[model samples]
Target chain A: MRQTILSISNLSKTFGGVVATDDLSLDVEQGELHAIIGPNGAGKTTLIAQLSGEIFPDNGRILFQNKNITMLPPFKRSHLGIARSFQITSLMQGMDVIDNVALATQANDGHAYKFWKPARDDRDLRQSAIDALKEVGLEGREFEKVQNLSHGEHRQLEIAMALATQPHLLLLDEPMAGMGTEEGDKILKILQKLKKRKTILLIEHDMDVVFALADRITVLVYGRAIASGSPQSIKTDERVREAYLGTEGDLNC
Target chain B: MRNLLTRKSFNFAFIISVGLLALLPLYVEMTGDDFYLDLANRLMILAIAAVSLNLILGHGGMISFGHAAYLGIGAYSVGIPAYYEIYDGLFQIITAVFVSGVFALLTGAVSLRTKGVYFIMITMAFTQMAFFGIVSIEEYGGDDGLVIDTRSTFGNFFDLEDTVTLYYFVFVSLLISLFIVKRIMESRFGMVISGSKSNERRMQSIGYNTYRYKLVCYVLSGCLCGYAGALLGNFTNFISPEMMDWTASGELIFMVLLGGSGALLGPLWGAASFVLLEEWLSSITTYWHFFFGALLILVVLFARGGIDGLLSKIGLSK
Candidate 1:
C-alpha cells in the first residue's frame, strides 16, 4: 500500500499535427524508482518537460502530494520539492562547480533580495554545496569551472545540483546519456544509493540500466503509454516487446 | 599554460588607477591647466552612468537602448526645479533617482517581456519618446534647453559652485558608486542575475523567478544612472532634451563595451579613454567623429573584451 507521490491523469499535448503526449496517465509511488522508456520520437522528453513545467499539456491534470500543480511555473514546482536533471546537462558552464550547486540550494532557502553580503562568504550555503558534491563523488573539484569538467562529471554535477535542492521527488532525464561504461557505472552506483532515499522517475535509453534500476516500467509509444507493470512483467509483456524493447535489440542483458 | 600575471596584478592596476584619479586635481593645478579638472569631472560622471549600464548589460545580459532616457529624466528633475529657483542639491538628487526608478519600473515591465533584438528596439523607442516629450515642453526651454541660474546648494557643508569642492564631491561619488556596484555583483542576488544571463531556461528550472530579479536590477541601474544625470546637470549648469537622444544611449553602450562589460573598473577606463580621444582628436580636426567611429570599430573587431579584456589577457586568462 505505497502512497502515490505524483499522479498524471490523462495528460495530452500536441505540436501542430504531431501528438507529443497523447492522453498519458501514470502514477509514481513514494520511494519507488519508476522508469519511462521509449524509442526515438516516442515523446519521452516531451513527457518529462510537461512534468517539470517546461511545457504545458493541452488537457489533463498533474497532482503532486495530492495538490494540483498543472499550471504552476517551473520555479513554483521546484519550490514544492520537484527537482529535475536535464538530458543535455544544462548548467551554468562559466561558473565554478560549487557555485552552480550553491545556487540551486539558495533558490529554496529564502528570498535572495539581500544585496550586501557576498554569497561566497555564506558558510552554510557553501557547505551544503560541498556536501552535495561529495555525495556525487566530486569532492576536490569544487572550484573547477564547469566548462572544464568531463562529460561524465557534467552528468554527475547535474545530479548533484538536483540533489542540492533537497527535493521530495527527482525527475531524471537520461542522467547517463552520453557517458562511457566507467562513467555510466559511476552514475548507476549513485542512482542505486539515491534509490533508498528518494522517489525517482527515471527516463533512460539503456536497457540494462532500466532493467536493473527500475522498480516499475512504463513503455511509451508515439506519446501514449502502451504498457505499465513491474520490470519482470514489462520484460515479458508482448506489447512492450513489439512496440519498443524489440527494436532496442535483445533485452536479455 | 599558466597565466603571465594573476588577478592580484589586475587588482594592483585597478588600485593605481583610482589613486591617480584621486590626485588628479593636484596634478592639474601644478601643471597650471584648469581645463583638465573639467575633463576629469566629465569622465567621472560618464563613468558612473557606464557602471550602471554594466549592471544590466554586462551582468544581467539585458540590452537597454533607452538607458539615456533615465539620464534625461534625472537632468530634467534638476532643471525643472532649478527653473523655479529651488536650487536644493538633496531634492534634485532624490527626485532624479525617484523619477528614473519609476520610469524604469514601468518600461522594464513591458520591455523585459521581450528578448534579444526586440528588447534593444523597444528600449530605443522609449528613449525617443522621452526625448520628444522633453522637446515639446516650452516652459523648460523646449528643444533650446535650459540653464540653471545657480548650482545646487548643500547648505554651509559644501558649495557646488566651487570647482575644487565639486571635483572632490564627484570624485567621492564615483568611488561610492563603484563600491556599491561591485558589492551588488558579489551578493546572492548577483548570482541569480548572472546565472539567468548564462542560461535563463536552466535558471527557471532551478526555481528562480528571473523576471523579478532582472526588473529590480533594471530599476537599480536606472536609479544610479539618474544620480549621475543630476551630477551632470550641475557640472554643465544646463539640461537639454538632447541628453537622452538615441545616439547618446549608443555612446554609453560603446563605453561599456570599450572598457569591459562585466569588469568592475572597465567602464571607468572606457570613459577616460573615450573622453581623452574626443578632446585630443577634436583639437586636430573638426570631423573627429569619423576617427572615433573607426576606433570603436577596431575595438569591436580586435578587442572583444574591450580595454579591460585586453588588460586581463596580459595577466589572468579570464
Candidate 2:
C-alpha cells in the first residue's frame, strides 16, 4: 500500500479580496511524481508557497508523514525533510556555485553553531555538494559565481540546492520555466530518476514535460483543484477540458 | 567578473601588512618618535571598531548607523567608575561588554525587525538616544567631557599606566579582534550569516532561522565595539558624549567601506587609508570634506569591493 506522504485538508488563503487558494484538499502518495497544472494566476505558485511554509493559508491543515505541520515556520518545515526550489530562481548570488549547494547541505545538517573550523575545509561537506551538482549535470562549474551563470544554469543550481538538502519530499516550482529543449530534457531525466526515491509536488507550465514525467496530474483553476486523476483520466475529464485543458485536448502536449 | 578578494588570494596582502604592524612598535621603541605610534594606535583602535561593524554590515547585511553608541558605553564603563575612584580593569572590561551586549540585545530585537533604510534609521536613533542620555548626566561633566587622571590598573603584573604598555595593549586587542572575526567568518555560523546576507528568504526555505543568527551577530558586533571603546578610554584619557555621536558612527562605516566591507582585513586597510587621506588632504587644502566626498564616489563607482578588490584586480594580492 502506498502511504500518503503529504495531505492538505481544506486549504484556503486569500490576499485581501483576491482568493489565491480556496478550499483545496490534495494528497500525494509516497515515491510518486505528482504534477500540478494550471493557467497563469491559477494560484500555482501561491500553493507552492503555502506548502513550503513561505506563507500560511487562511485555513488549512498540512500533514507531512502524518504529522500536523500547519502553523510551522518555513525553517521548521525544512527541518522536517521538506525541500523547495523557487520558480523565480532564488539563489545565493555572489557565492560560488558549489558553495550555494554546500550551504543547503549544511542547512540540512542543522549544526550551524560551530564557529572556528573552516566550512570549506570540510571535505565531506564539499563532496556531498559536488555530488548534488553532478546529479543535476552541473559538475566542473563549482567555482563559478552564481551571478555569472546563465539563466538555465540558475534553474539547474536551484534543483541542485534542493537536492543538496536531501529531503524526503521536494516542492519544485516551475523547474524548467526558462530552458531550451535540451536543458528541459536534462531536468526531465533528473526528475524521472528522483521520483523513484522522493515524492515531488511539481508546478510546471510546460505541458510536454508534465505528460512525460507525472505519475498523476491535478488541474487547478482559480485556486481550486477542478479535476485530478491519472494522466488518462485528467485528459478525458470533460470538466477539466472546459476549466483548463479545453484547447490542448490531447495528453501528448 | 573575476573572483574579487577570495580568501585564497588575500594571504599576500594581509600577512605582509600585519607583519609590518607587528614589527612597528620595535621601530618606535628604537627611534623615540612616538608620533607614528600614536597615529597607528588611533587607527588600530578604530580598526577594531570597524571590524565589529563589518560582522553585521558586511557578512550579515545589517547597516547599523548607531555603532558609536557602544564606543561611548564602553568609555563610560571606564569613565563613570573612575569618577568614583573605582578603576579595576577587569571590572571596567566586564561592565563595558555587559552593558553593550544588553543594549544590543534590546535595540536589535527592535531594529532587526526593520529592513534596509529603516534598519539604518532605527539604529542611528538608538545611538542618538544613548548620546543624549550621556549628555544629560551633569555629575559626569556632561557636555564638557571627563578627563581620566589615572589609567586602569590590573593589580601589579600588567599596569596600563605606562604609555608603551597601553600602546601594546591596543595593538594586541586589535590583533585578537581580527583573529576572532576571521575565524568566525570561515566557520559554519559564518556560512549561514553570509548566506542570509545574500538571500534571506532562501535561507529560511533552507532551514536557517536567519533572524536569530543576525541578532546574535548584531550583539557580538556591539559588544566588540564596546571593548574597543574601553581601550579608547584608556588611550585618550577622556570620555565624552561626543565620542558616540551619529557622525562618529558614520566614520566607522566609512572605514569599513573604504577597506572592503566583506573582506576580512578590509576595515584595517580602510582605517589606515582614511587616516592617511585625512592627514594628506587637510595638509593640502581646508576643503577636505568636499574632496573626500568626491573621492568616496570614485572609489564606490570604480572599486566596488574597496581597496582589497582593487589590489586583487591588479594581481597584487594573489
Q: What is the DockQ of each candidate?
A: 0.60, 0.64
> Can you list the residue pairs that collide in candidate 2?
none
Q: Stretches of candidate 1 above 4 Å error?
A: A245-249, B1-10, B316-318
Query: What is the per-residue lDDT of model 2 for residues B121-173, given as tens digits with 9 covering 90 to 100?
Result: 99999999999998999999899999987788887768688877888888889
Q: What digit string (tens of lDDT, one per residue) describes model 1 on residues B72-118?
A: 88888888999998989999999999999999999999999999999
Q: After best superposition, candidate 2 residue B12: deviation in angstroms?
A: 4.4
Judging by DockQ against the true structure, name the best candidate: 2
Q: What DockQ does candidate 1 have relative to the true complex?
A: 0.60
In terms of lDDT, the poorest run of 10 residues in model 1 chain A is: A244-253
Interface RMSD of each: 3.9, 3.0
lDDT of 1 at A39: 90
